[model samples]
Target: MTQTASPLPERGPTGRRTAKGSLAAKSAQRVERPAPLRQVVYDALAELIINRTLEPGQHLVEADLAEYLGVSRQPVREALQRLQTEGWVDLRPAQGAFVHMPTDEEADQLLGVRAVLETHSARLAAGCASEAHVARLWELQNAGLEALAADDGEALVTANADLHSFLTELTGNAVLAELIGLVDRRVRWYYTPIARPRGHDAWAEHAELIEAVAAHDVEKAEKIMAHHTERTRQAFHERPEAARE
Candidate 1:
């Protein structure tokens, strides 16, 4: 009789493979780890800058920031260097690090691009938004209203971003969302000072946009978004002297 190849060893009833199993099965499992300290510090510092907690043109002392963040100075230094590269901080040869102050030209250029993107986002959202999506927009709008009533600047900023971001999501365009993400933080930085003063009118325009999207009125949605973003751009330009600094 012809010899046949030995049959493979049976796997354990519990499904654990024996040592004689496939080589791929013996590979080590991946170990998930916390983010590196330098990256964490970088994110924290970038957030502070965006939220206006670290005011534009304010000095960034590594020791003070390290102490505040409860980390060592090396990570803070690395984070500051990254922030400077990203235009969030300025590194002076003799004076050290300071927050980067945005100019009118910078604000206009960015906000103008934002208007174009957001208007397109609104038009697409109107065409495709489900009732559930519109309801979520209202919820975000209400959150912004509550934040405004409480005069909580930070919460207002967050809520405003949440509403706009959700609208961008309703557009069903990944590339558009990615473009918005690139400018979102700096837009927040420019918006923080104006969040309170612009709160009432901004939310009103949001209501109108939501209504247009809910009605599936594409042209109306686009028009409302265009106006809303232009108003924000105007608000930035007209911000008080203190806010400009």
Candidate 2:
């Protein structure tokens, strides 16, 4: 394996490096082990896809990634396989992987799932969320605002994830929370760069959602969240390329 380029560093909202190597490498394959190269490859590709660098329908070149990430072909192949399983990439037998362009029906289906799970989350949060949880969500909302103002696509993504995760935790339903968690990452993948231009109405939507949640308006919260998810689905189809931003 040739380490031709530096590993993909953990990036900040604006494509700056926020972290480097850790304190030490107490290395082992299993215990105290580094993340599998396949996972690193998966994250790198997903980030690129979510950031709009890897356009939808673009082919993913495994050999190129292997050389770029300082790994062997095996890991790159595995990562592409994982992405395929996650609905981000499509692979044909004897062919290769390309970015996934979900159909209008498919995007609607995804939004349906998000709507069901997240609306339930909002209702539960209204009943169960505490003062601190609401506060934390507000903090995350402000953070998202900052990212949007600064035009930091990645940071905006991170902040959005934080907000959803906070709401899930506040709901106090571990099972439902786990279910949402499974799809949450995928949701982020769909929205990160697309429909998120600076000064988009997205910030206002966030504030409205937050206010509904804080007011413990379960019906209002559920309705707004459902509408939000549906709007996102529409955006996805309206601009087919919005999947990659």
Candidate 3:
């Protein structure tokens, strides 16, 4: 005779399902786990790429990266595959992995989007800024100047980003801030090479922008920001080491 499977009993031998037993089904959901090794490796490699430590088109040898990151080849291989999917790396049939070299078109498109978002951000900031906010903007401007004077490219990039980021914060628009955050790292990556060359002029534009916001000159702030971002886009196109490959 064929037998049918029995359903799990709601009541235990004690005539009731214990609370502990009821919770067993939900235990796995509640347990927290640290990031997987592959994920951690992916983040580290992506940062290296974004910061230009892993320059575009550089060969990524799995064993070398594994040793450098103090992990085995497996996670590095996994991370590189993920990077390739995300356009940060390119995996070849026989040549292994390489960093993705952004084209002029790619840079232009991203910077163009950045200009639009930032122009609006400046306009909103001008209408919303207080004396305290203007002071913060000046503080950031001063920091940028100090970085420029010291010829510290890294610090200059950070200060430039900080000042722009503050303007977005002044807008009090979460959605706008999220949009800018998406492109922020890529913008930093592109800006790094031109940071020193663009330093003085960029900071001067920044000063004018701060003044417009301080005066609550909304239209002036918008126009200044549009010009400022367009100039940076042009500078990237004219970069001495312009990528042709």
Q: 31-101 in candidate 2: lDDT tens per residue?
A: 48677667777888787776656666666667766766777889888888888888888886765677776
Clashes of each: 0, 1, 0
Model 1: colliding residue pairs: none
Candidate 3 ranges with C-alpha deviation above 4 Å: 1-35, 242-245
Evaluate residue 163 in candidate 1 and report its C-alpha lDDT on the 0 to 100 scale.
91
Give lDDT tens digits, candidate 1, residues 21-106: 68557777668998898998898889988987677777787877777777788999999999999999999897788888889999
lDDT of each: 0.87, 0.73, 0.86
Poorest 10 consecutive residues of model 1 by lDDT?
Answer: 8-17
Which residue pairs does candidate 3 place in steric collision? none
lDDT, residue 21, model 3:
75
Residue lDDT tens for model 3, 94-174: 666878888789999999999999999999999999999999999999999999999998899999999999999988999
Which is the leading candidate under TM-score? 1
